[model samples]
Target: MFRWDGGPVAGGFAPAPAADALRQWRSPDGGLWLAAWGAEHRGTYTGWCVDAEAGLVLVADASLYDRDGLQSALGLAGPVLDAPTLLLRGYQRWGEGLPQRLDGDFAFVVCDLRKRCVFAASDPMGMRPLFHRLLPGGGFAFATAPEALAACTGLDARIPESRLLEPLFNAEQLAHFEPEITGIQRLLAAQWLRADARDVQVQRYWTPGQTRPALASTDVDGWVEALRWHLGEAVRKRLADGVRAGVMFSGGLDSSAVLALGCGYVPAGRLQAYSVLDRGNPACPETRAIDRVLAATGVPATCIDVADMQEQAAGALDALAASPRFVSGRNGFLPLFDRMAAASGVDVMMNGIDADALFFYEDLLERQIRAGGYAVALRCARKQDRMAGEAWMVPLVRRLRYTAHLPPVVRNGVRRWRGRASEWPRLHAALLRTDACEALGLRARARRHLALLRRPPPPAGGLPTQTLHGAVNLDGIGRFHARSRHFGVEMRCPFLDRALIDFAAWIPLELRLRNGHLKWILRKAMTPHLPHAVAWRGDKFHPGSHFDRVMLQPVLEQVVRDFHGSGPAIGRWIDRGRFLAAAQRWQAGQIEAVWELKMLLLLEHWLQHNADKVAFGR
Candidate 1:
């Protein structure tokens, strides 16, 4: 475990010893690097290995990294290798050829004295964070968290006011830090950076791609079969570790597909499935559906009732504020998952997180619109009413209602010019600007959509679609990875494996959203492996639903009190009467407007609390 002066630190160090040691190690050539924090009992250490022959440095949590595999893979001499080992034995994993090939959540930096270079990298999804500051001297200083570096070096930790505003107007951009913080940036996902005295180079090691095959005839069945093959292989690769892996099942099509594929790799009896259910929630019905799928697959499953443990939700909020990514307000799930994983003795936790963006399905209307098949588009749009209760209709309705709230002129123009040749571009632009995109906190969705539309249609019809989905998936994966780092758990998203993503990219949009259903190809491929009910089921709960009941109530009350209190950031940006009125409306179940307001309130607390520690630069 590595410890620095910022964030939460665990260890047994007196105030004087800890402060002095940390200060000495903050200089450019200071022979120390901070690592991730683990449990409270074990004190963290940061220092360099003196031996020239010391191989790669492996720092990880106790739960994930395998010691025997590390020794074998790294070609160590004996049970007690000469090299110094930071035994985050359970959390960090290293082995010969394993470091490069390993997937899932991790952040690591290996200083190769032999090569006189330091190689650092984070997981493809960026579940772990490593920040580096190029010093005035020749050397570079790095740490697991930015706050740690700031604390050690006496630098400020303040974020830019613009970054604070961006999330209000464009919540999706919260994943990125404000550009004003000089010399501070996150390591990109799937990228490796090497720094030596002479130079530093960063390069991406993986890219997800799919190319449509040139065919004399359109054979949809061939595409479907190929998708299944690649997806199965993806799941198998993730289950490579002999240790048991657990799936975060939701009974939805995406998770069911992952669960089924996982079961195929591990024996049914050995595979463990987990799901979260908020008791008394209307969405709990999905949990029952998940139960049915578990029975059909014969996989052992555990359901964590989140409502039963609401207190943990408060802790999740505080942790999120300390780390400060786009606060999802749904972070309570992290603690819930951790408690379950620790209890189950599970090392790897598989989730269906990236499925939405990777295997995104355009509604039936979108398919026809893309084809310029107006009649078909109209037919599907009208049938939307008849298929109102179907699985795909809810998101579609959300999209429509969200789009309807645009400025009066824009909304009226769209309604009047429906289906006209001259109106196509205008209508498309309006739909792209839906408020749901903003409400759901999709940060750069608009900018990305415009970028995609500017490009000419692909010759083979794969690149454009793949680029769109890949960007969205990468952003979500990046955020998920960040949150996992905050929670001290390694989160694995099976759907994000390069092979599975490529397969999803290649599957035709028509097959993905046939007959008004989303994720059709995935559902069809896993039909045999999953229960019929689960295979056909639709409807997903916004895990953030309980935010209003559990979090917002306390947060709003606190915001009001803090607004009245002196010396908080809330007093700076929030107007007293307006903020109070919004809180009252939110209390009356006007939940749609609560998210951005809640984010602002949280930011206020964070800024006030960290004002002294964080330094802002332009």
Candidate 2:
């Protein structure tokens, strides 16, 4: 938080903040104010508050997964050290290099009073959250939660329509759009922000390209051997002492792999696992695969029924309304999950957030097409067919379409065709007021943003994989942290560990994905530990399936009623008449539209709840 050097504004700063301000730090000069609040994680150091000199102050909301790795890098040893102390020492030693030298889920700000500038960074995968705002005259404010900055006495807390249109336009690529722009401006993953009195600048400190192995090798078994070591160490690092850690088990390969590997470190009797089961929805049932892990490992598990949480919908909306950050996920069950964690005395939660992106195999054909020409791309496509024990032409055709040999027009035409083919049902045309959308140039702006995703991957980075790192990875992390923080639990992902990412970064794409398989190397590495059914599973659960199955009927009804009548907040951006007709269909049991409608409802509630805090530019 930033404040006036002194005077009435300084005194107005809250002496005791409500739920939003979990911890607080103020500059002695009365020019800056910073705070952290919420369910503080029990074991891991989050840099809740840092001890620093008068001119230099650093506050961090971080949970380092690889503390041992960081300690080894910093040359610290012996007894376990305080998280803040270790963090401050590293920051003081390496400055901006601190992010590169560390591996964890963190977002922190270092204020240089002497230089009159500030430096900020998020974890490589963006597991933690941070937001900043430039004030009217001078000075700036940053916080883990946007609400903290919105609560500032002097800062302009008006809502920006562009922020709302971002997720609407880009779909899942919201985090990749602009590292500095969200509902409020947000820092991108592996990127850092620096601000001075005159200006603010955001720069990338690290990228997957920077970590490509010194010697790239295509040996599959060799790659698997290395992955096993790195992946094991990654899971072990998160098994910190004293805390009762739990895995967010979904019975999928990624989470199952994490659970299997984690059992080696945590004893079966002490092991804990949690899964969100939809007892009511046959379409999205929790697979018996989870039972296999529990039975094999003897790890105790807890299952929560989404059916029980319909009553909490209002409270969830109220929570979403209170925060200024755009909640990108459609999951309506996290609030209940967190409450369960809190009740069960679980402090740290581990998940398999980016295993798919890390081990992406579908992009292999494209990568070969770009680098080794059509012949090479065809060979890979054939290899994929052979591995799958079938003749397949789709991979070959898809690879050829994206090759460098193709004209820009041809490539773009293919992309546009595919994009159109995959386009989800959007809000009805009548739902958006043409005058308002035109005034904001909503369609034009959305087109400009969508075009960015079509550009070729950098020469040094993997195709689509690099794009994943910059785009969805950043957005997903912020959403995860927001949901976790709401219940005061710290979430960690082992697959995102620096060592694992570095290893996965340089391995040949064919080894990562083959024969229509994704994360192929990961499956091979964990085959010994995971069940054959899980290791060989081919299908992925759509992210919205569970939410659609459980909450669609109830949530949609409430949102439709609210949208057509009392919820005029979203009307500022959407066309009310169009939305009303769509809502009618949604109400009449045409539930396929639930996914799109829930998003609008979330946006509507967000706008309505924070109406006073927002100022339209009109």
Which candidate achieves the best lDDT against the true structure?
2
Per-prediction TM-score to the true structure, in the order listed: 0.67, 0.80
Candidate 2 residue 584 Cα shift, in angstroms, is: 7.0
**lDDT tens string, model 1, 1-618?**
222222232223222333243322121232434333333111112233333345334433212223355555555566633212523221135422233454344566665434545667665555555677665545556666565665445565565543443444333433343222556666766677877777778877655553445432257777767777877877776666554677777677777788888887776455688776666665566767776887777888776555664665665456545554434334345545554564566656677776666655333333334455454434444454444454344455445445533455664456444423322243222222334334433334334333322322222334425343333445555565555444444556667665455456556656665654556677777777877777766545544445334654566677777767763464544445666667777778776546536656555645645665333322
RMSD of 2: 4.9
Give the C-alpha miss distance for residue 7 in model 2, angstroms: 10
